[model samples]
Target: MDWPFSRRGLFQGAAVATGLAMASRGTAAPFDRLRQKNHPGWVIGHLTGAQAVAETLLAEGTGCVFGIPGAQENELWDELKARNVHYQLVTHEYSAACMADGYARATGTTGVLCVVPGPGVTNALTGLGEALLDSIPVVAIVGDVGNGEKARPFQVHSLNQVDLLKPVCKAVYSVCDVKQIPNAIRQAFQAATCGEPGPTAVVIPYNLLIEMADFRCPPLAEAGVPFDDAAFAQAVALLGDKRLRVGVYAGLGCMDFSGSLTAVAELLQAPVATSVSGKGAISDCHPLGVGWGYGPHASEVAEIAFAREKLHPHKSGIDVLLAVGVKFSEVSTGYYGNPRPKHVIHVDVNANNLGKAMPADVCVHADVGLFLGKLLTCGDTLRRPTDGHLLAKIRQAKADHEAKLKAIPAAKCGVDPLALVAALRRGLPEDAMLFTDVTASEHLAAESFRVTQPRTYFNPVDNQSMGWSIPAALGAQQAACGRTVAAMIGDGCFLMSAMELSTAAREGLPVKVFVLDDHAYHYMQMLQKAAYKRTTATELGRIDYRAFAQAVGVAYQEILVQDHLDAGIRSAVCHTGPVLVRVLTDYGDRKIRWIEAVRDRYAKELTPAQKARFASRIGYRTLSLKPEKSD
Candidate 1:
């Protein structure tokens, strides 16, 4: 029999995975490996495709797989469990994708999600889009309908999955033969983690999953960050200017290099700011850390610290902005209001993102880790004596900001959103994983939340996918056992993903999900009331969340008054299983500064006629409302 394994391919793939490592991780040696080539990488095995799939996943260091198995993928799902590879069954396909995303973000490793074809692919698209835009590494293993020699048209759950996924995935691979399954899956992992990471899809026909074939799947080396020597030379030369007032704007790309980032910041004597997704890349407690964003749309502390006039008598706010690993997305930049300083040194792993948001004096296409690492090599040239004045300004701004945050209290009706967020910040573990959804409180949390480590805080900023936090928290909890994981979800967002809470309860993931119960889509209400002078269709049904929690087989806690805040958090944290915590929230007369800044920038872009129309509508609506008849 002619061997189906390729000799050329075996030599080309992998640094290699140790058998001892696989054993330690509880994965049994591959199901049926009858013969192996001279090279250990090539495991020529007479096994079903499902066995091949499970073996590859274990080798790739995937701790858990999140998805709902269906008819098309049942065989593969069974194989995964047979090998002792942990798999969590989610309630919805969308939640599966979100969970995978959460796992990837929290653990800084690739997340895997498996689903059947057609509806499964469609249902998971939104989560994939979120992952893609947020630069998350997720591998979506989708099972396609049979396309063997006798393949027929119009098969059940059969659609052009590859085309459907292309919009949301970084790359998509369609496997034809059973022998190709291992390489296809391995390549998916490589694609998912390479450079600017995002979701990658590997489509395997269900027929192939059950077919027996000889396999030669050798895992490939994980992708490494790019380093351009000449670009580093150019960047170093720019930083060598001792007279330049430098400021650092870091992003998610700088996550793995936080230590290097901190070193470079101290050397440059620069204040550091981050994008929303980039929060926690530097410890917010760090003296040099000014908080997220560095313009009018940013934190007041960041705005003040970056203001040249505030720090110096005559110099500009930031003479040179060292922006790394962050894109100026509309949400993060507040309609691109983030500063475009005189000399912008924008560096990123993804070349496409560089120089597109803000014009750059020097654009460096390199991984943030590699770039920061190179900077440390010539630390002396970039080193500057610490400026007492700059440090004093940042310290004062932070102190005042903290004082302001501490002084705010909940309004009469319910807990103030920021007050709740601040309480959680104080009560939760310093190293806890916090995920926030798209809501008014998200902005409030961004302003007041204190994060001490990289990848500790996450938000659906660019995608603005409501209800993302619930599943995301559970997903992260699955990967991060023993660490606390929490989600601050709005009442409206809670409704969108309320079913997913049951998945956590079933899987026993201890994720404290807090529902900011305002009895309405208050985030939308705020936006609409400002634009239309009256809210429409923003109200949500008042839910008896305690009862809902009982139905879902989880512990329930509610923080109605300000007095119960600490006790409520403690109860949830101490609970053994998943807990749903509800905080009655009031956004009355509270301001989300990010929203205000975005609205202001948007208003400036409105034509005079457009403004007049809005004004006319507001006037008409205000005049049309009749006074209530008092008895």
Candidate 2:
């Protein structure tokens, strides 16, 4: 069957067509020899299905696989070891998938994994779901029961694996025949790396993994769909409007073309803001980068900076928004509380996403890299005034925002979350990659941490899943090789995947783990207090992280006060091996109140009806007030 954007035709032509083109040269003899019917390269090689899968992945330039070995898929592990491919062993199947997802996000490559069926596949669903939601490329190879054992009543780890993964994966392929191994592997990678990239699954029966086969590898094709040129021209026209003050909102899709993205912003003299998932697409320190903010729930500093820079259309100045690679999802758009530009030009690889959340005056269905490249080429002719005054205003606003964030009062009880984030930012290298879980620290990091490179900061933004940062950091560190990697996680999030600490020790991966020990699910606890005046099951009793670290064979440190934060963070950063630094932080009520204050200040601009609706939506009814009232 033919597939969309299939590269089969290119593969078929590469060997022969290139040979004929080279025939006029003296080097054609080697090509002629290769064309012989008895050529050795064309011969059917005897390889087990597992070996074939490994070979295919190697050919695709895969450097490692994050997975767990299971009874049914032990042969695959053996073959991977024999082939000298690195297998990052994880304790849980879910962690394996998350590791792969994190690896893919950091490296911009397809992350591969292996797991057994039944609970193995089920356990991987959350990680795959996170990948799906975040548009990350990953291929999960699952092991199923043998072909002849279909529907056996008591077969261990036996279930329909394809059905289980189909909902979360981009595509699911169940290989029943050994000969289909090569093609199936190719298809899985293609699906995972193609447009709207996401996780794909390939379920091969355990018996086939051990069976020998004469595998004929097919040529793989690069996948991308052509975009509409008319829409591109229309977008250019809209952006060229001198009357509109343009602002660029970037998302994950624009990561590949960050240079061109920044170039376009520079040409239009527009400030660039990013979605949380899109942080580091451009250096946050760049002159045109106004810092990360697209939604109302953005970092307090980002929100304040955005408002001061006049990037928010409703607040004051910007008339047009160039949204690239953004989904305009609830998190990114703050449930649509963020105002839409009077004129919007939306660009996305997925056509369906163009107007799915917010209407666009012009929609371009194209790869962000290509689209931005084209836009840059035409940008000179459409250059704007450069707005020196506006640029200065933005710079000043950024300084003011930083000053305000630093001035936030520390909690009376424990280390301030903001102070902890600041210390971490100072301690780590500029290029160090950071992974964050859904916690109060995440919000603080969003406002304080400055990501200077693409793929340097990763968060479970859309999924908001706990226990993601630790394993994800492991995968990212593996992909980064010698580069430093760190995870800022809450105590609650740390415990969810705490077992993976052993995996880091075993692999000898030096990932600095900073646990914000707040003794509760701080984010939800704040919400509970705001909405219901009480907290529940969210609190997690204090953990002895030093004891836990010793048991897991990792380095450990703890900081209870502000004075030792910098030194503690620096020591962890300089550690050559995995280290867990637990910071006993306060309840973060101060930060929560600061955010509420910002929200209240901003809500004054909205009409009373709009204010009421927004308050209800965000569960800020208690904090809501009459339009005329002062704090």
Highest TM-score scorer = 1
Model 1: how far residue 216 lies from native, Å = 2.2
lDDT of candidate 1 over 360-417, digit per residue (tens): 8888999888788889989778888987878888889989988987888757887888
Q: Please estimate how well model 1 matches the true structure, expressed as its whole-model Cα lDDT.
A: 0.86
lDDT of 1 at 58: 79
Largest lDDT belongs to which candidate?
1
Error of 2 at 25 (Å): 38
| Tens-digit lDDT string for candidate 2 (268-290) | 88878888789888888888786
Let me know the TM-score candidate 2 reaches against the reference structure.
0.86
